[model samples]
Target: MASASPLIDRHGRTISYLRISVTDRCDLRCRYCMAEQMTFLPRERLLSLEEIALIAERFIARGTSKIRLSGGEPLVRRDIIDLARRLGRHLGDGGLDELTMTTNGVRLGEHAEALADAGMRRVNVSLDSRDPEVFRHITRHGQIETVLGGIAAAKAAGLAVKINMVALKGLNAHEIADMLAWCADEALDLTLIETMPMGSVDEDRADRFLPLTHILDDLLGRFDLRRDAHRSGGPARYWRLAGTDTRLGLISPLTANFCDGCNRVRLTTEGRLYLCLGHDDQVDLKAAIRDGGLPAVDAAIDAALAIKPRRHDFRIAEGSAPAVARHMSVTGG
Candidate 1:
């Protein structure tokens, strides 16, 4: 009721998608995600299900129609399924239109059925490499078969699934063709994302940065990449694979910035509402919730929307360094 004007930022962009990071803890030690030894938010500091739901309610009420649960690995959280079940209630009728999640898929095999049963619409699993050694090198002991099994389990549970592959030059870049063939054979939606220069994740990015430009060139040179319209507020550009039903997508925040169409914001596990993934600007939602509940939350959301940056500055920061120096895991990337 308080937010009658809708959640539009200064640039007139309607904020309809929200990515909520339930926990900062993760099982893998991805080379490009976070350092092997990382400090995560304490349990008491993380928002409870009630707090998460209330905050989500405020956003949904203000024209936020999409919600995606994210984390260092959401399945690592004990009550994540319960959280998903609770959050899924805010869909359809007068609530959110969709609720999905992004995960590493390490534990997906065990939780896929429960997650889908809990009302999850779909899921995106980040699997960088299909080779066991490369997967282990990128994720520090991540088993390719295990993740493949998880992906299989998710599909078996009747949930639509997508695979996210971060294209790292020299490391996993050579595997792009292999990944595409595998995804095509499996009929899985596959998206190749250029690595973001997020803090420590970018330490070797100069060497590892694999632009989607080359990948796109390869795909276009071989097959017809028919552009597809996207309804989700995500940044990935969708494409239909020629004569097949398999889909292809590219998320090139570095090479081709999609800031002008940024329809989403993120809530960190500790409750900071980040306007842009490449900036440190945030509104402290945990403080607002603790201080004044929904009234304060509404005010915080309003304040956040008022100053939300129209586009991120990941391309042109200052030096060769990334614009934002925060870790992706903690930032809820």
Candidate 2:
């Protein structure tokens, strides 16, 4: 394996962002995310908090500057704030530049202050609909009020919050504009995402796959949107919404491929590093660590980067299997 500071894949993209899924367990079962009766990994199979921090340290040492902690609902993990604090220590003076999270907002109300105290300045919360009935239907059994309260708490704790909404054709498509306006009113950033074919869920993804192009066309007539160069170290194309401080982002994985500049990799809870979201290319860092500690893990990472694919094979069709067998929760959102 090659010894390098910043990991560069064979495709020549610099890898600087690392997303770690601390656990696969979630408090809610969103229809687009997973099955209602999903089987979660056993606790013993997950990387201990200490091990996650150690491996994350290796990535930081290799020039990973941004780290985002995610899960089915990251706040659901016990002592997750501890992990944030451990990794937060890496910030400042030529170390990790940013430490953030992607959560469902179910438990954010309870942990927001701790997370802010742990050095997190921002977070991305997944919320599909503001309508109570629609929200419960999409999430199967989630209370929108709980999520809203969590968002309130996060903001109160001085964390900049961004709302992530998965666009669904018949379900929430009519509410996208309303959601954007609500985001603007709340002084929050809003990102519209096209549903990806990741896991086997109850509904047909093709029916819910609302191309962002159609949504953008509708918004163009209503809002004064201009292309913005703001990048949040993710795959979203940003636009500055005129008349408000809200920045709108669109993540269209199917219609507009964003893999050419992919700069991130995912680390599963089980210690597997997935090169691409829609591919199975992986390296077992947990085994590497248990077998030979940090040096072995470093070599394994280099080997994985050498084989990272230039793009992912993502497609959506009726009666089709997922792009990969694994769910989005397994790889983190």
Off by over 4 Å in 2: 1-4
Relative to the true structure, how large is the alpha-carbon lDDT of every model?
0.84, 0.93
TM-score for each predicted model, relative to the true structure: 0.95, 0.98
- Over the stretch 49-159, how does candidate 1's per-residue lDDT look in tens digits? 778888888888888888998888888988888888887877666777888999999899999999888788689999998888989988987888888889999999998
Tell me the tens digit of each residue's lDDT in model 2 across 1-333: 222567899999999999999999999999999999999999989999999998998889888999999987888889899999989988895789999999999999999999999999999999999999999999999999999999999999999999999999889999999998999999999999988899899888998888999999999888999999999999999998998889999998899999999999999999999999999999999999999998899899999999898998789988888898899999999
Error of 2 at 25 (Å): 0.6
Cα shift from native, residue 320, model 2 (Å): 1.5
Report the Cα lDDT for residue 101, model 1.
92
Candidate 1, after superposition: displacement of residue 291 in Å?
0.6
- The candidate maximizing lDDT is 2
Which 10-residue window of candidate 2 scores lowest in summed lDDT?
A: 1-10
Flag clash pairs in model 2: none
